[model samples]
Every structure is written in C-alpha cells, then in structure tokens.
Target: MENKTKKNAVVLLSGGLDSATCLAIAKSQGFDCYCLSLDYHQRHIAELHAAKNVANVMGAAAHKTANLDLSLFGGSALTDDAIAVPESETAGIPITYVPARNTIMLSLALAWAEVLKSQDIFIGVNALDYSGYPDCRGEYVKAFQAMANLATKSAVEGHAITIHAPLIDMTKAQIVTLGTELGVDYAMTVSCYQADSHGEACGLCDSCRLRREGFAAAGLADPTRYKKHV
Candidate 1:
C-alpha cells in the first residue's frame, strides 16, 4: 500500500446510485476523492447533471468531466440514437451495452490517477443485479488493473495502483442500504436509461426494474421519481 498517509483516489462518478454510493464509500475510506464523469453521448444528460450534484454534495476534492463522443463509433443504445432503450427480459448481453465503455473510462481515469499520483481509482461497476456488462465483472477489473499498472510509468516504478470496485458483488438492495447508511440522497441521482425530460425514471426499463426491486428488497424508500409504480 506504499505508506499512503496522503491517500487519494480518482472515482468514476456516473451520477447514478451505484457510482454515487461508490463515491461515498471512497470518502468513508479517508481518501481524498477526485471524481470524473464522462459525457459519452448517452441519451440522458440528466445523469451528468446528477453526477455534478453528487460530486458537490459528497465534497470531492476535485470534479472533472470529459466529453467523449462514443456515438462516433455508435453500436449500442447509449450511443446510437436509432435504437430504443429496451424494457424487455434481458435474455443475454443486452444491446444497451456500450462496447469498451468501462475500458475507455478506466483508461482515462488511469491517466488522471497517474498525473495526480493517486494510489487507487474507484468505480461503481457491479456484477450482481446488473445488465450483463462484461467490464463490470471482477476478472475484467483485475485485468484492467494489471494492464493499467503495466501501461503506466507509475506502475513501472513500483507504484502499483489499484482499481477498486466496492460494489462488484453487492446486489442493488445491498448497495442502496449502504448508500442510505452513508446518508446518500437517491433522489439526487439518476439511474434510468430512459429518464424523462424532468429527470423521472422510466420504471419499465431493466435499470428501473432492478433499482425498484433492489429498494424493495432492502426495505428502503426509493426517492427516485418513477414514471409508473410497477
């Protein structure tokens, strides 16, 4: 751990519940957090706004946003405007999966972490109760960490950085519970792919369903605005 008396980390804050919760977790760990959000041409800019709010509320040491046009390589619903965000059964890997999103985001965060001389980067990726995004898995994150260490000067100099996924194994309900204990305001975060103009969550989408069910399982009140109570 290299005697981290000045422990600092870069957090990938998507302004969603998980990411926001991750930010809180990082803070709780006594890390001076630097939050990074991306504008990857997703359907909703609302999430970006929520990210900003979360960063400010959580008291990030620094908050930065990057504008990357993933739509330029459009294939997923998040980038391709032609495809609608699905609300059906997620049989396999959903179409909404943006190719290499976590990879790209982590790459950028790695660069920032090196520049900041931070020892860790926190991401909100989860494997349980999540759409089948491969990058969210523990193996993928581990591989990325190794790659990051090998690819950067910091790692080459024996400053082995870590990619922290505090929510990797947690279900959404457990996540919600942790966030609630951390005094996180779920209403301030947006998790819906199809959020309305007013920032209300579309209760029919996979994300919405998972979020609602998680809250139900945790016996917590979801403060998010839903299009309908399913």
Candidate 2:
C-alpha cells in the first residue's frame, strides 16, 4: 500500500551523482522530499542547473536554492579564484575541500526542516571512494545530528531530527548500481568540479575521474558530457 501520510524530508541536492542518488533513496523511503540547493557562488553554476533538473524529474515536493556567497571568504579551490582545481590526485585533503561547506549547507537545511516540521535531512556525503573531505566522515555527521537534536525546538519537544547519510558507506560503484536500480537519470546529474557554463565536464578533475570510474566499475556507459564532446 502507498503511504498515505508521507513524512517530509529536506534533501541537500547538489546536482551531483551522489546527491541525485541520495534524493532517489529518500523518495524510495516514502518521504515527500523537499530539495534544497545551495548557490555558494562556486567556480561553476552548472551543478545548480543540474540540481533543478534532478529535483523536477525525480518528483520532489519542492525545490529551493539558497544563495550565499562562499566565494567571499575565498579559502577553497571551489570558492576561490586564486586556487586552481587540481586535475591529478594529491596527498592529504585536496584544495577542492571547501572549508566547513557540509556544515554550512546542513545548517541551512536544518533551518528549513524546522520550518517545514520535517525531522529528516538527507546529505550525500560519501566516505569510501571519495575525495577525502573531513566533513564527509561518519563521525562528523553523527556529531552534527547530536547537535541538531539538542539545538532544535522540535527535538526538545520529542521530534528528533535524523541526519541521513545513505551514501556514506557505499563505494562509488555501489552507489552507481543503486542509483541505476532506483531509476535515476545519471545524465541529468553533474559531478564535475570544473564544469563549463553548458555543464560539460573537463573530464580530468577529481570529480570527473571518480564518476567515470564508478560507471566503468558498474559496467555502465558514462553519460556525462565532457569538454571533448563540446
């Protein structure tokens, strides 16, 4: 039987492969997903467009883009024009790691969830086969969830907020397989760190490499548009 009283969930949709798959998972769990996209004034706006497309096609109850210029701080490669996004893998956390990005995005999502009286917030932060961001770790997510429950009025009144990181443990290939099974249109998602205005990937950045590898590992043809194609 179809769930008559669908619970609301706030999903942080980044228009990336992981986030798109996360949204699909939330929908599969019978939540009326409210997609949230952050316009942090990153190097590219292509992912924002992809986010909108994913939200619409995936049947999100609502989609909202929050505007905050993280570029003003200028710390990470994604936000700072001075820092170049590396095409090759490097040791330690890459410069592409935005400072406290996940924390900031989740805080925004938490606020929206409170207003909507939604107890769930979904973030697509993978650990395995990832770019080695500190915030994407399981412990960080758990800590944030604890803080959220303590800080929110809803949680104080007995409605505890749950932070869902469904993709945290899944490998890139596993995520690809799962998303495929869930009917996700991978082409609509953009995971490139240096995507062009038209959303064509550079096909050399860390993100593009991972995404391509994932599809290959899953024995699926990558549908991502590369700069070569343009």
Candidate 3:
C-alpha cells in the first residue's frame, strides 16, 4: 500500500506527557514531525521547556513556540493567578478548563498544515484522562476537522486535512506504556499546572494526581520529582 500520509506532520506539543507521547507516536509512524508549542502565559512554564527538550530528543524536524497571551483573557486557573488549580478530580468539568484553547491552537495548526500541504495534524487530547474540557472531547475534534476542511481553501480545492488524536481513547496507563515502548523518557516530560522555578512537579495539582496515577497503574516509577504518588 502506498502511504498516503506524507513524511511531514504538525504535532501540537505542550511539553506534557501526552503530547510528548504523541510526538513519539507520529515519528514512529514515519512522519517527520514539526512540533508546535504555545506560550499562552500559563502558570507553568516548565512544560514549554520540556517541549523543546522532547522535540530535540524525539528528532522532530523543527520545534517552534507561538506566543499568544491567553493570560490577557484570564479566567481559568491556568492563566489566572487568583484561581487556585484544583488538586482533586471532582465530578463534572473542573475550573481549570481553558475556554477555546484547543480551538485556537488547532486553528493555528490548521493554517500551518495548509501552508505545508500536510495531510495530518496530531494532538494528544484524551477524553478519558481529560479534565472536563469540552474541546478535548472526541466529538469536538471530529467537528473541528470537518469545520477546518470546509473553512480552508486547500480543503475546498481538494486536499483534505485530517486531525489525528491517537491518544483520545487511551487511558493514562496505556499512554505511559506506549511512550515507554517508543523510548520516550518520561523524565523529560513535565505535567504540573503549578511548578517551582526549577520545574519540580507540584504533587498536589490535579495534573500531578493524574500523572502519578498513570505511573502507578503502569507499574512504572515516575521520573518526575514529586512529593507523593497514590
């Protein structure tokens, strides 16, 4: 079978485990990756640094950071200092949901894909592990793909864009397993909403809870520095 997917792909990397895994997956699938990270003025800057390192280690074609001040529109915990990031996973949507974040990021990624004429864009969003973010849902991604195709001139002309979310259905443990198989060093990835200046993972945030649980469930030691894991 002639491979329809080109060697080039744009990956949305957040310097987190899921995104790093996505990058590894894309590369393993024979796609030369162009990693895109965003500096949207989130509380944690460590993930951005981690993204760069992961991209380098994973051998992405290029890793670029886009500066968009989502902090200017601060309402969510990630962007606002006044809002405390929840440490536990409560029922329903959490307060950490950044409004339209994936939407904005994916739109930018679509533009890049259209310019490069790339058929695939990989994101690491997962519904199971996700924290009640409306945009992270599988259905939303599909809708976004359809909308993107119709909105873009390239898709209108004939070349359709595919938004690929391989980690959408997988649990965190499964993701950890896949990343381990792919030779991804989990130590290189950071998943803390609030980290110290040196990027030490905060052991109390919801993100930390998820990461710790994933490692525990996978029966693997988390390489990240943490206070505790359960």
Which predicted model would earn the best lDDT? 2
lDDT (0-100) at residue 99 of candidate 1? Answer: 96
Stretches of candidate 2 off by over 4 Å are: 1-4
Q: Model 1: runs farther than 4 Å from truth?
A: 1-4
lDDT (Cα atoms) of all candidates against the true structure: 0.91, 0.95, 0.89
Ranking of models by lDDT: 2, 1, 3
Candidate with top TM-score is 2
**Model 2 per-residue lDDT tens digits across residues 130-194:** 99999999999999999999999999999999999999999999999999999999999999999
Task: Give residue 67's lDDT in candidate 3 (0 to 100).
Answer: 93
Candidate 2: clashing pairs of residues: none
Which 10-residue window in model 1 sums to the lowest lDDT? 1-10
> lDDT by residue for model 3 over 29-147, one digit each (tens)?
88879999999999978889999999998898998999999989998999999999887777887878888899988988888888778878999999997677888889999999999
Model 2: how far is 6 from its true place, Å? 0.7
For model 2, what is the error of residue 99's alpha carbon versus the real structure, in angstroms, after optimal superposition? 0.5
Steric collisions counted per model: 0, 0, 0
Rank order (by TM-score, best first): 2, 1, 3
Residue 69 local lDDT, model 3: 94
